[model samples]
Target: MRAVLNKIRPKEKEEVASDLKDVFDNFSEDDTINKAKEKLEKFIAKWSDKYLKLSNCFNEVIVEYYFTYIKFSCNIRRMIYTTNSIENLNKKIRKATKNKQSFEKSSRLLDFLFVIIKDFELANTDEISSTCFLFLGGLRHNYRHGPLQEQQS
Candidate 1:
């Protein structure tokens, strides 16, 4: 989405992002996996010509292994598809580590970093019970398929 948005004029980017958000917002309203898949396909088709990056990204999000490999739970969380958690983790670790002048040893640095990670984990505890995939709200676990692996380019 960011890739496609970067192509737009700066003046129209915010409005376009908001429009895209509306389309994504509909996912939570869908009551079943098929309905959510339908919405995703519709969204891909609607933006395929205009935003190839978004089309590919959404396609990647829906796959046989993705549904099969992840042990999803009812405790769904919003914006799970975004890289916010991973990025936030990086930022928090950097900020926490930067406070120290230097580590006496690598083990000490590792221990400090571990504490930072644990603190972040405790803060975002939703990740422990949240669905591994987006649009998984109220979705059934009937999509089990093949083993998990990296998506081929």
Candidate 2:
């Protein structure tokens, strides 16, 4: 979508971009699939007059899959809608493999990817570790105190 947006003439880019952003802002506020579709339809009607190509692109391509997000929670919807996390991971993978022309086998490529993913996981383990400790402590406290209260009663 950003690629398509970039194709707009420089003179019209800012206005069109701002309009599109406003449409997305409205769409994101919708808690239901039906409301989201309504918002999109309204945006298409409003913007089509000014940016026919951009509006048509959304109507023809993007709206087709818009309902798929309805089953997901808002947090997941936000994550899926944004490209930052996946883009960052892709950037890291591209940088790591940029110098290599080709892998000897598919397994070799998979091995490299596995190592990269494992390294990222290990780098992020501190937060996970602390959460795990807090969870385990709560469980231990409950187990120790729960039986004692039951026996006294």
Candidate 3:
């Protein structure tokens, strides 16, 4: 695994470093700028090597072993490194579920979450598709299209 990671390490470092540089260059300097630059440089230095390893592992296991072997490629995102979007979504869901102390079952919780997600998705489907793949995963899993699964009297 390490050998595999080492192979693609340089490309990954370059990509991450370039991306960090772009983001860092956007901010203007005060004390915050220096702090952000320092943090970002350190992060790029540390994770760039590891990110390739992680990606390679995923490629090897999920893509090669599972997807290729099975001949089915899923649309799952490789990295979910960013979290602010989900924190905000959870805040919204928490507000909605504040009144309910206990969910009767996991499915009930899922149903509630689905409603919240579907309503949000109706407004900004594109942004939701791009930024929040996991949210899309949950939505896809929970979605019931066509006629209702259960017949109504």
Candidate 4:
């Protein structure tokens, strides 16, 4: 997929110009450009009322139409928005479980998180604190000793 996109992208500008030239040349009836412009204007005017009516009709029925057809539409944004939050949460949980595969019980997981919250509370005690210290402390808490260290100590 990526290779195909890159392959086509190299020729995009030339391809677009070629398509535009074809479209422009297709409407020409005479050697004069003004005749082409005149024909384009007449053609646009002939369809303008139908276009306007369709636009208004869609606006009036949008809610009903959307409910009827939105499920069939493949909207990336809607799919991402609905799934990303839960996906991110699952990713965090997966990382947590990967780091500590020995957590055989839910209570142990809760206990580990409780210790982390407590450690952060303790680390935030002093008024003169550095962000680096907090970040390092949190990293160590999550990845290094964890609650097991405190239990052993």
- Top TM-score hit: 2
Provide C-alpha RMSD values for all models, in order: 12.8, 12.2, 13.3, 18.2
In candidate 2, stretches whose alpha carbon ends up further than 4 angstroms from where it belongs are 3-12, 26-30, 97-112, 121-153
Q: Residues 62-123, candidate 1, lDDT per residue (tens digit)?
A: 53332321223323424344567778878987888786899766545555655565566667
State every prediction's TM-score relative to the real structure: 0.45, 0.52, 0.37, 0.22
Global lDDT of model 4: 0.40
Error of 4 at 85 (Å): 1.2
lDDT of 1: 0.54
How accurate locally is residue 60 in candidate 2, as Cα lDDT from 0 to 100? Answer: 45
> Predictions ranked by TM-score, top down?
2, 1, 3, 4
What are the per-residue Cα lDDT tens digits for candidate 3 across 14-99? 66556544533322323243354455456446665655444333332332332221121223221122345567667877899999
The models' CA-based lDDT, in order, is: 0.54, 0.56, 0.48, 0.40
Question: What are the per-model numbers of colliding residue pairs?
Answer: 0, 0, 0, 0
- Any idea what lDDT model 3 has? 0.48
**Per lDDT, what order, best first?**
2, 1, 3, 4
TM-score of the candidate numbered 4?
0.22
Clashing pairs in 1: none
